[model samples]
Target: MSPKNLSALNKTHKLLLNKLKDKRTRQIYNKFEKYLNINENFAVAVSGGPDSLALSFLAKIYSIKNLLNVKYFIIDHKLRNNSTLEAKNVQKQLKKFSINLNILKWNGIKPKKNIQSIARDKRYELLLNETKKFKIKNILLGHHLDDLFENFFIRILRGSGLNGLISLDKKTQNNNINIIRPLLNFEKKDLTYISKFIFGFFVEDPSNEDDKFKRVKIRSFLKKLETEGLDKKKFLLTINNLKFSNETIKFYTKKNLLENTYFSEKKKLIILKESFFHHSAEVIFRSFTDVIKIVGKKYYPVRGKKIDSIIQLINNKSYFKVTLGGCVIKKVNQTVIVSKE
Candidate 1:
C-alpha cells in the first residue's frame, strides 16, 4: 500500500481496536469473522441503527485485521425532517471511534406512494454508485435474525413463491455488486448489545414503530404469533428446508438454460427449442425467467404471473409475439425466440 493509504488505515485500526477491548465486543467480532471469512477491501452501508452500528464496528475490525481498506456511507434520504441531522449525529459518534462516514443525499422529487420501497431503492442506487467509485465488489448490510423472520412472513403474506420466500440469503448479488449480510444468524438483541457496549449510542428510526407500513404490521403479527406458539428455531428450520428446495430448482434452471437454450451473443438474443418446454412447468418457468432477465438486462426477474402467461401460450403451440420485462417473445414454427426490445 502507498504511504498515504497506510497512514489512513493505521488511524482507523487504532480507533476500532481501542473499543474492541471489551469481551462482548471481541466475542461478537469472532462470530462475525467466522461468518464473513473475507480478506478483501469492502464498503458498508450504515443507517445509524443498532444493527448497522454494530456492523460498522465488526467490519472495521475485519478490515484492519486483513489490512484491507473499507469505507462507510450513510444514505440520507431526507424523508423526515430530522433525517440529515440524525445522519450527522451518527457521523460524529463514529468519528470518535475513528471511523469516518460520508452521507449520500437523495436529490430531486420524492415519490408520494410506496415511500418506503422507493426510499430503499434510492438508498441502494446511492450505495452502488459509491461501490463503483471505490471499485469495491462487496457491500455489507446489518440484517439480523429478526429481519429474516420478518421478511419471511412478509413474503408469505404477499403470496410469494419459494424463491421470494427465501431471497434474503447470507450473500446475494445485485447489479454486479455483492450484498453481504453477515449477521443474519444473530438476533437483534445481540446487535443492540454490541452497539451499546461499543459506541454507547444508536439511532432509532421512527418508521420502525409506525404501524402503517406492511413490514411493521407483519412484525406486529409475528410478535402475536410468538406469544401464541411460534417456535423460532422450528420456523428457521422450515426456511432452511424451503431454501434447499429453491436451490434444487435453481440447479435445474441452470441446466435447462445450458442444455436447451441457445444464445446468440452477437445478436443479444436467445433461441428456445421445443425440448426446452419438455421439463416440468416449474423448471421451465424458472428457466424462462432467467432468460428474460439475461436478455432484458434487468436485475430483477419478470413477474411470475406474466411469465406463466407466456409459458401457457408456448405450451399451447400457438404463434404469438408479446413483449414483457423488456424482452420480446415470439413463436416461430416449433421454436421460441426471445430478444431484447
Candidate 2:
C-alpha cells in the first residue's frame, strides 16, 4: 500500500478512537458491536439525526475491527424546503469523520394527504432498492425503544391485531433483505449522548415537534403519562407477553399452511382444500392471510375483516368467486383456488 494512504487510514483510526474516549459511549458502542456481529457487507439508513448518527459511528467501528464493508446512505425525501441542504450538511459532517455517505433522492410528485405515512414508506422503498442494487441482504435502522413504544401505541389506536402490535421486532424479513434494529433495547437519550459527544451536532427534525402528526401527539401524551407514574418496566413486560402469544399463533399458522394448503409450481396459485376451514378461526384466518400475501406478492397482509368475509363466502354451498388483496378466490367442488388477479 502507498505510504500516503496508509497514513490517512491511521489518522482516521485515531479520530475514531478519540470519539470513543467517553466511557459510556464506549460501552454503548460495545453493546452495539455485540448486537451486530455480522461479517458480511451491509448498509445503514442515516437520517442525520442523533439516532442515525450514533448508528453510523458504531457501524463504522464494527466494520473497521472486523474488516467488513458497510455503506451509509441519507434519503433526500425532498419534502421540506431545506431538505436537500440538510442531506448535504449531513454528508459533509460525516465526511470529517472519514465515513463516506451516499444520498438517495425521492424524485417526482409528493403526497398531499397522509404525507408522513407515505414518506415513511417511500424512505424504506428507496433504502431497500439500494440493498438490492448492492446485493446486500441486511439494512440497519435507527429505531430505539422510544420508537418501539410509539409504534405500539399507534397500532393500538388503529385497532391493530396481535400481529401488527408485535410487528416491531429486532429483525424482520422484507422480501430478500433483512431489516435489523440493534438499538431497539437502548434508549433515545443514550444515542443522543453519543451524537453530542462524538460529533457535537445532529439534525433536529421539526416534524417531531409538530402536534399535527399522530405520532408527535402520542409522544407528548406518553411524556405526560410518564410523569403520572407510568412504569416502563411493566409496559415492556406486557409487550413481551404479547409477543410470546403472537409467536404461538404463528406456529399454528405455519403448520396449517403446510399441512392443509397446496401451492402451484408457478408460485402464483394456491388450493385450500375443504378441510382447511375446519381449524380454529385464528389458524384459518392466518393461513388465508399467508396464501394471499404469497400469491399476490404483496409486502403487507390483507385486512382481517376482508379475509373473514371471504371465508364466509367459502363456507357457502353455492359456488362463488371473489377478488380482493390482488388475488382471486374461487370455489370449486370441495376446494378453494387462489390466484393472482
Candidate 3:
C-alpha cells in the first residue's frame, strides 16, 4: 500500500474511533462488546433503519478492535418505489466513515400477500449468497429488545408452539451460517439515539407505521400495554424463565437423536430404530425435525402439522414408503430408513 493511502486510512480510523468518546455511546459499546465475543470475520446486514445503522457502526468498531475483516451489505428489496434511492443514500452516508456498503437488489416478482415475510426471506437469500461468496460463516443482524417483545406477541397471536414462541434468540444457525444479534438485549430507543447522533439521520420505512401489517399493529398494542403498566423488566424475566424450560426440551431432543437414530454419512442416509418413536411427543417431534433438517438440507424444518400427520401414518402402517423434505422414508421390518430422494 502507498504511504499516502495508508496515512489517509489511519486518519479516517481515528475519526471513527473518536465517536466512542461520547459517554452514552461508550456505555452502549461496552455493553455491546460484552455480548459480542466473536473472534472471526463477519458480515453485517444494514437496512438503512436506525437499528441496522447502529449495528453497522458497532460491528465496524468491533472489527477494528479485533483486527478482523467485516463486510456490510444492504439488500434493496425493490418492493417499494423509493427503496433503491434509500439504499443508495444509506451507502453514501456510510462512506463518510470509510465503511463501504455493498448494495444487493432483489429482482423478482413481488408478492401480493405476506409481503413482509417474503421480503425477509429474500433478504436472507441475498445475504446468504454473499456469505457463500466470501466464505464467511457469521452474519450480524439488527434485531433489538423491542423486536424480541414484538415477536413474542406475534407468535402468541398466531397460535405458535413453545419452540416458535421463544425462537427469536441472540444466536441461531441458518443452515451453516451463524446469525448473531448482539443488540438483542439493547433497546430500540438507545440504538436510534446512536444512529441519529453519529450519522445525523437514518432512513425510515413507511411499512413500520402502516396499520395493515401485523407487526405495526402489535407495536401500537405494546405501547398501550406500556401505558397500562407493562413492565419490560417483568416481561424479560418471563422470557428468561421460558428459555430455561426450552433448554430442557432441547437437551432431551438431542439425546433422542443421538441415541435412537444413526446417520451414515457415506451413504447419505439416516436409520431410525423402533425405539425412536417411544420417547415423549415433544422429544420425538423435535428429533424428527433435526433429521429432516439434515436430509432436507434446509435451515428451517417442515411445518409441525405435516410432521405430526406423517408420524401418525408411520405408526399405523405395517410397511410404508413416503417422501418428505427431499428425503425418501421407508419402513422395512422393524426399522425405518431415511435417504435423499
Instruction: Arrange candidates, best TM-score first.
Output: 3, 2, 1
RMSD of 1: 2.6
Candidates ranked, most accurate by lDDT first: 3, 1, 2
CA RMSD per model (angstroms):
2.6, 2.2, 1.7
What are the lDDT figures for the candidates, one per model?
Answer: 0.89, 0.88, 0.90
Model 3: per-residue lDDT, tens digit, 211-277? 9999999999999999999999999999989998999999999888889999998899999999999
Q: lDDT tens digits, residues 1-341, model 2?
A: 79997899789978897767789988999899888778788999999999999999989888888888888999999999999999999999998887889999999999989999788878888888888998999899999988989999998998888888877888877777888998988889999998988889999999999999999999999999999999888888899899999899989888888888888957679999777888888888889988898887666677788998998888775588889888998998788999999
Off by over 4 Å in 2: 1-3, 265-267
Give the least accurate 10-residue stretch of model 2, judged by summed lDDT: 294-303
Alpha carbon lDDT of residue 177, candidate 1? 85
Cα lDDT over the full model 1:
0.89
Clashing pairs in 1: none
Per residue, candidate 1 scores C-alpha lDDT tens digits across 126-215 of 899889998999999999899999999888887888898987899977767889999998888889998998889999889999999999
